[model samples]
Target: MNWKIGLADNWRRLHTKGTVVLSGGLALVTAFGPAIIDAWNSMPPDLKALLPQGIQRYAALGAFLLILVVRYLAVRRKGGGDGAA
Candidate 1:
């Protein structure tokens, strides 16, 4: 099957009530990505120094993924099988 068709089908199948909110969040993130990066880069040296050198991006990504994993587990515990809650 074509990748585009498969993606569309999977999206339709997986979409839930929270899809709109998720889509909106993604749109906002995409729109503000550059500004967000610029802000991070412009933080005061002392503030940036809080994180270890060369690990800022990885730390941020790990924290974000951890939150997502926790949320996923919470939803599963709540029996939110479709993750709409």
Candidate 2:
């Protein structure tokens, strides 16, 4: 029984998730970016001062990563089991 197939399958899954995250992030930025910028601008000065420019981008990335991780765990719990590998 070859183990390389399992490794390849995992790599493909990770690549797919990464692509989904990036594309989803781009779509989110295109859709709600104005609202995000407005919200940031409206934040209290002291609070805003705690985070530097591009914080929104970082927040978006963090949110997406959290989402992906949760979804992956949920699927794993549901017995997806390496997805046919």
lDDT of 1 by residue, 8-74 (tens): 4557645442444455565687688899889988999999888788785775576567556644553
TM-score of each: 0.41, 0.42
- Please identify model 1 stretches exceeding 4 Å from their true place: 1-16, 52-85
Sliding window of 10 residues with minimal summed lDDT for model 2:
71-80
Residue pairs with backbone atoms closer than 3 Å in model 1 (clashes) = none
Q: What TM-score does model 1 achieve against the real structure? A: 0.41
Clashes of 1: 0
lDDT (C-alpha, whole model) for all candidates: 0.64, 0.68
lDDT of 2 by residue, 1-85 (tens): 7554345455756745645666676687769878977987898999988887987678778877876675565332355575642
